[model samples]
Target: MDASIGRTAREQLTGRYVLSLVAFLALVYGVTQDIETVFAITLGLAFVETISILRDTPTVDSRWVGVGLGAFITIASLAWFAWELTTAAGTGGPVWFPALTALIGVWFIFDARADFADGTDSYAPDDMDASEMMLVLNHGHLVVEELRQGPKTVPELADACDLTESRVREALDVATDDGMVYPVDGGPIDDVERYALDESKVGGVAFVRSNGKRILRRIARPFRR
Candidate 1:
């Protein structure tokens, strides 16, 4: 009955179902010798995945990287298709063209899959609303929990949280502002900021996690109703 849990479950289910359907349709098109349909479907999926990455990632650099790579692949695919359509013989240039493009498309899909598998989407708070602020706090609390295991650089925290460095920095800012975390004394020469939880904070990681969960439940109550 927990709305947050239900919504998460539903999202997972829907993602799986949609992916499977796309795969099935692609296979059918391939089997029927409908190369155009297959290419269209592959392109559509790639475009969608690119948009999803842009929307979900919390950093400008990540967004730009995704957009750049996606645009290159899409443009390349379209160009190849155009060449095929406009050639003197009216037949495609070579088999490798479509195959290579298909491989690029598959790579994009796999990248999106990897992102989902690592739970990166959960790291970014959707908005500055009360519920979202609580989510941000929860994220910060989780970062603190990771730091309790050991001091970590921003990149390490980003890897742990499946988020971009910017997103991790955002969470750390919240924790730092709330006096839940503080910077470590020394770190590597790369100028990466290292963070550790403030042991002086009342109840430490346990308290933050517990309270954050309670707040999240309260926020999800209206959705359940």
Candidate 2:
């Protein structure tokens, strides 16, 4: 299962790199002949990338910022395209094009910075406890945080954590044994078991509420070195 997951991740990374290369080449080609086409294609690629990022990191602030930026870029690109179409052939565009493009470039830079700020580098620890610590620091906390809102079945937890149901079940089992999570009544489901955080446990609740950013940095510490 681990090998299969690694293979799937590799395939996805390869595909993203290839698509990015294609988009970059297309943008360069469009720049030489049709500036409007460049804007349209760039906007499309930006939207695609934004959607991919949001899927991987479904945080509320990131979602709102990404959507706002995407909407603005889409509207600006469309307006520029329309202007180009209406303008007479061989006539130049407005003087603000360069300034607007520069602002957009800055936006991209900030967007990338934000992604890095919220993202963590992958790490592989040899020790079993180390591995478990990393999981509890990241995915485990995420699961508990989600459950803090309400109880959730395995499938719901998996979806919330962007993990497989089997993986979520395994994590839940461990957490249950540790007395961090408890089985709750499964609503409308006969066989499925729902889980919730045991708020009565002070340590568990504190760990669930711990600073996520700090935990992510700790996870990436070894990798950074």
Off by over 4 Å in 2: 1-129, 187-189, 202-225
lDDT of 1 by residue, 169-207 (tens): 889887776567888755466565678876767485766
Writing each residue's lDDT as its tens digit, candidate 2 over 114-182 gives 455657322111235666767755777678788988889888999989988877876776677647799
Clashing pairs in 1: none
Task: Please tell me which predicted candidate would have the highest lDDT against the true structure.
Answer: 1
Residue 173's lDDT in candidate 1 = 84
